[model samples]
Target: MHLFRSMATLVSITGASLILVGCGQKSGQQKETITTSTDSELTTVDPSKTTAVGTFNVLNNVDEGLVRLGKDSRVEPGIATSSTVSKDGKTYTFHLRKNAKWSNGDPVTAHDFVYSWRRTLNPKTASQYGYLFSGIKNADKIQNKKAPVSSLGIKANGDYQLTVTLEQRIPYFKLLMGFPVFFPQDSKTVQKYGSQYGTSAKTQVYNGPFTLTQWTGTNLNWTLKKNPTYWDKKHVKLDNVKFNVTKDPSTGLNLFNENKLDMAQLSATQAKQMKNNKDLISRKQSSNYYIALNQKNKVFKNLKIRQAMSMIINRPMLANKVIGGGAINNDSFVSKDLAVSPKDGSDFTQDVTAPTSMGYHPAEAKQLFKQGLQEVGRKSLHFTLLNSDTYDQKQLSEYLQSALEKLPGLHVTLNNIPGRVILSRQADHQFQATVANWFADFSDPITFLNILTSTNPSNISQWKNAEYDRLIDASNNDDGGNAEARWNDMVKAQNLALKDQAIIPLYQSGEKWLVKKSVKGVIYNTAGANYNFKDASVK
Candidate 1:
């Protein structure tokens, strides 16, 4: 079934209203709780296997790694209480907090992390995020099946001591540890559930501030209850967190008006209409949304055709006129707020300029399109454009179709499906072109640039450039210890990708929401899960 329709049905449920029941304070007790809505349903609960935003939201509360994002986006100790790096910056040793324990009453030790990391790096796991572990010694070899998983550079010196070796210096390694991919998993629980692990709440174990319940793997509603076993439970004020999957803007607004939800994500139109509302808030996310043209398609393989397609879209109009509320037009694939130049400390986006071919020019686009058609011996070109079925995605796809169809002899057909279906289709290379977005896993340019490499599983475009690959390799391996040299290499690689029109960048997303004034202390990170409710409270 299409996920959008399923979510709509879930949101339409009346009577009983689980939101009130879940968020209400118990009798004679002063407890805080929150009711919120996500744009879509969660795709997975397993930390190592998930790539969806909704899934990350749940995992951030139910599981944790060596470090976690604290209030105000500060890095705080989680399983590990302290850590030290070698003088060469190639080795790190962590001392685990002995008080940490899983929800099932099992101790969370360094061995759990070793087991989890090896599982994620194993080729049998088929994790798309395996590329994230590249800098760890032997990680690439393990992913390529050239070395055994046991050979990966992680060791449990004792129950509380964990040591890690790296091939080169990674300035953002601490930040990377806060991501879900690096979280630990219980070996016994994983073996007990076998393939069913993390498919539903029943098959998962929690080691963080909350425990998931009532998730049937296909439902649109779920509940998060405070985990009494959490090591840092004293700081967790929320007794429960109720989440409802909402796809329609009208429904979310109605829920917010009815006081059934403490926070609701708003559409651009809704934000404009309710701009005067005191509860309205806007969050500028560090993310990039773009269109990925599959180079496997014969028509898309032409460089002039790709450049023409990219140049025809008016990004400013899309960001301001179509989707307002502070959404910024982006000429490059890397987000504006992602990172800074190591040499000058200036924002990465400000330090680099996009290639001329990526700029908007209708006349030049028409001429290039005509030349491309002549070169490919075609009078007209037609291709399907794939996107999610959410309200915003539908609008974005329609806008693209209208703009691209204005070019002579070019036709675009949009296929709007469920979010899950769109992800599967992209991974399988089932579309000629598609609109997609990438949220950075860490605060670095390599987090965005590494995905487009030829061997990275996330490169759905099937674009392979020898020079681009060489630059990325050098940034990660050869000059990784030299921050300035690594930054220059990455910038050159991004420029080359733009010159070749690897992808057409549209705009960086801006999150708009209506949040209750009583809620406080929710941490919003520039990378990873985006939200952390560990210290959240409602008065």
Candidate 2:
């Protein structure tokens, strides 16, 4: 998923013993509840419409896909009890659990998945994530509006069986299935509310361990109650999980100290201040923050200007001093330590060297900016830098504004807004430049590279290169099962994007949190959905 906000509050606590907390209510005892803080507000809970990590975090508990990510991100059966793959690795058949049922007591059937998938691929749905269905047969055509949605290669074999056909072998198919966007939706509930489905808590139904409630469309808080009818309800220990939106670190810290919150995300400054606190914890994320220059703007189309912008800023200082919370500088769009060489198991970052033209060089940047202005026939360059209103993003955007203005005759404006607003503006290509980030939807390099492709909906920058597209396409479809060849193709694509300055890689995102010691069994993963609290308990 493309992360428009920092997922700091989505803490990772996995594999811990499930002690009795709120497993069952005794006659007069109070129900155990865990209150947590989120920095960004969710715009929608609809799986097909979600584009933010915060919403995915919520759906990760309230919706169950064919499979679920377990401790360490292992693939575990959820709605599907088991699955089989064809000898060609191009087809998959899933056997759903007979006991699975929605909150409305309707049996979860294979037809639900077929309907959900077709709805997402429907052009009217306008799901930004439709690009993720590339490997599925006829999906590209359907998304392009060149074929009917009924031609999609997914079918319900019967009431409890589903089969999916792919145009090619998708290395991460199972991992992608665990994502919320691929989760099944009850057709009855969706049709019951029509356009209003998933707009509020009452408009949708749940099939996961938790059921969402009290979330009006635009509210700042919501509650996740343990679903009594969930298939795995016996293992759910928490009775209620309360989520509060607290954008200010100070406010969250105050609430945490007051014991009002079981977990609170800390800002970089707050993390430093609470370095010695026993409750403070830090987790690394498989996400990359970068600057996207909209090529649709004539000022950004000049290659030298893009290179000058990349060279003028100091990434190490920005990561360590401006956005620090264990954040590390990144040289490429694809995050470091995400994937490795298929042959020797060396880290992907170890194998790909950053372009020599990409490092900080203020003197060179000034000269390039002067030349670029001449080529573009402009004495001065002016643009706006869009960023989320969160504390960390504000600081990072300010740093960029100050650094970019250092160029002669360059004027930079800061447009700070909520994360949801940033996403909306970027999606419409309504901004000059924006600080954007991508969290890996699956544990693969294609997750990041595909988003930058010319035809991908997520490529808001509008940067395109035929060679780059060819390399990525070959890696996705034409590698012929040669692991080393496929790896090399992707490596070449990453190198090309960096050399062309299509986007400026800033740093690898990390999170700092203050979680109470009693919160247990919240599974965390660097990739995929970051947190799952289905089995979580508060002691």
Candidate 3:
């Protein structure tokens, strides 16, 4: 359920004066290549279809949106040279760069953006990301099949000029433009390939910093060659970026030791062992991990049972002892270090408080468990906890099983599967409970809070409350113009969700890595695509 987004770049430099090694080839024509590894296999290269971290990593490099999340998470112009907002803030007009072109040498125009947006909102596309276009006029109606895609409130005034009308003013609309879901599509290529489009590297086209190559329908390895047609190709330093799928931490570490990789992520245990290693670096990610209790299950339908489940786990211990590397213990769904209150510029996490029941209270939990079991008229309860097959996820599931079984008449089992399979199963509601993480798609608290809304396609837990929905709706409409009022409404909604025990928040993740000193200029953001290697170079 974790919609993977930004990853922070952790770099280790020990010397004040560093030697710069030129990675140039003898011919001075071939570009230098950098190698990296990912833990999960990519699901798709299509911007509209991708939902996993691996796919986002590739697309973030290979495709260019109207605007791109640049170094330090700042918004930078991409295909669009500049933009202007109407006085009322309901309309946006983008002026595209005339030199931008796709990999096939075709001009990238405003129509491309219009077509891509409409296609994403088309009911036939079945895009889970269409929800992101909610504020765009008629976007929600189009996605819900109530209106034609032609009415989506976006139009191409000319080859380089585009206009977008919003149903309401969206504070984060510019940031939203940087997301992969908002990237333009090559309609000709998509229609030509039909279902085969984006299934393999050969079927795709690129207009960003890199062009995907050497990726078949399924493979453990792929290459991203610099896109010569890119408008800002002069700024793209690396000749190529080679990526290999390495799910095993030991194997990734071994690769890094052998000088085969420029960067590799380390597990908590590995990171602890290498704490003194000069190459070790840690990054605090803007994400939250939690166990989503499926409300559709008869046992979980009891509020007491859900509360008991939430209280049994020691989140601080899990974050520090089990999943160390700067992981922060979190009880609220919205991650800390993400947003701030517009009224006083105070941290959002500090303004809201989860109920005390969210903390470890085994004594109270036992009493709640007893009451819950009696309410359900069950003498004993047994359920399986689903999780990813990764070493860390498996360890987390085992820890939860051990802790939850302490309750009387509770028998817990663990089921670990591949990351993709786990996501698919969760989407199908095939589990009673599962451990999941959600990375912010944007900077706002709404990025995390909106997912649990009654109508969100990403609501795997199936938890719903009328008041919660009302608060979120009010924040978007009644309080839309008032930042302070909207912030208060969101904070209230978060408290209500936690009070209902909608999901048990465990910790906010922190990425740990071993990176080569030679790799430089890599941009990591807290939102959108986590990593951007467009400016990266091996020196």
Candidate 4:
């Protein structure tokens, strides 16, 4: 599940200058286009429907929300020039930038924001990100089909001001505004295109720094042309940004070497080979990669089986040798450096009170697997491991398949599918086991913890623990105002999940990329969309 959300411009590690090859136009002038590659294909540009990082990254560039992420993941003005908060922190009023206009020449008004929020919260829309609107007044009721979408606590105060009411204060509400899911959509365009909206480049309109072009309903490549109509277009320097879907690291590296791409991500093997390359830029992500077993499967229903599965994989070796780069093994679902304890200022992962569940112990794992098989009235176990068709994911899946098969009488098969298909299947609970990634939408442990709640759409595994749910609920509502108490509740919830082996937390992502020195000002966020090209330029 590419379930997400921010960030700063990337600086070179070795201070080496790389060159970006600019495409030449018919006029003989070089176009400032920064060519990049993503391993996954874009599913949709619709903010409401996006679940994959590729979709969110595309939407992040082609759309504008109330606020946009700036350097260091700070909230900066977007369509909204300024905002004011009520003393209770439940009411937020945003003053829209009067000059902002959509690509279609319609003024970007407060009504657009109001309409967008209501549309996403509408049960008929079936937005997976709807869970993110939990604290908004009437949002939960609407999502649960108990209230009408119109009852959502948001209104357009005239044409240039929007007011939002929340049932309770959300600590990361401001950060959420910068996420593509919270961006405003054009009501007229959406209504005109109906369900076809966002299926292709021409079906949607843009109000951000760039306008998408050259994208068919399904294509391997696309372009984001600078939006002349953008309110802040003056600050957007790149004339065009080109993207290609390159699933293989070898292909991406070749593209980079051939000067066809400004940036290319490296595989663990490639990262090792390029360790001394000045262009090698390594980024530690606030994201977690884990294996989620579907509880509906009989073999996985046994506690011992689940624990044994986690124990079988050598996570440290996976992170250090196999995944390599700067990847780190983790025991808890919440990635480190994501949040700090309000009480002691320690990293959230440092205070986990649970026993280590991620350690590799083949002997204990084999014994437990044998017992689990007998308990389940089976002599052998077999299941498919679903994963994305990217090189890195394929490698990880292969490693898991080889490791899990080490358990006696356990046969594992790999089902590598497109990223879009994986998202769809994961949402529908169509797999027995899947490799999933969670990119934090904000700098909070709750972003990772709350997703495992029994009712959350992101909880594809259907893992449920009443105490875990209670702790998460308390953290969000009862102890939300008390920072220390909320932190404690989240800590307990994380430890509970780890102790239960709810999911096999593998590693925190440490992606290495070969970026051209000529590309500058691109904002790279570890947690969310990962890239923002608004201020980016090809020098």
- Point out where model 2 deviates above 4 Å: 7-30
| Clashing residue pair totals per candidate (backbone < 3 A) | 0, 0, 3, 2
lDDT of 4 by residue, 382-438 (tens): 899987666666788889999999999999999987766777788899999988777
Regions of model 3 farther than 4 Å from truth: 1-30
Q: After superposition, how far is residue 29 of candidate 4 from its true place, in Å?
A: 6.5
Alpha carbon deviation, residue 119, candidate 3 (Å):
1.3
- Model 3 lDDT per residue over 357-418, tens place: 77999999989999999999998899999876665666778889988998889999899776
Give the Cα error of residue 482 in candidate 2, in Å. 2.3
lDDT value, residue 328 of candidate 1: 83
Worst 10 residues of 3 by lDDT: 11-20
Please give the distance, in angstroms, between residue 373's alpha carbon in candidate 4 and its true position after superposition.
1.4
lDDT by residue for model 1 (1-539), tens: 11121111111000000111113233346566787766666666777766665566567788989999765456899899999999999999999999999999999999999999999988888887899999999999998889999999999999999999999998889988988789999999999999999999999999999999989998878889899999999989998888776777678788778877777767778888989999888776566777889998888889999989888999889998776656788787888877888778898887677877667899999999999988999999999998877777788889999989877999999998876567677777898998877766667899889989999877889899999999999999999999999999999999888888888888777766787767777777656666777888887
lDDT of each: 0.79, 0.81, 0.78, 0.79
Candidate 2 lDDT, tens digit per residue, 256-277? 7877776777778889999999
TM-score of predicted model 2?
0.95
Q: For each candidate, give its TM-score against the true structure.
A: 0.94, 0.95, 0.94, 0.94
Candidate 4 ranges with C-alpha deviation above 4 Å: 1-30
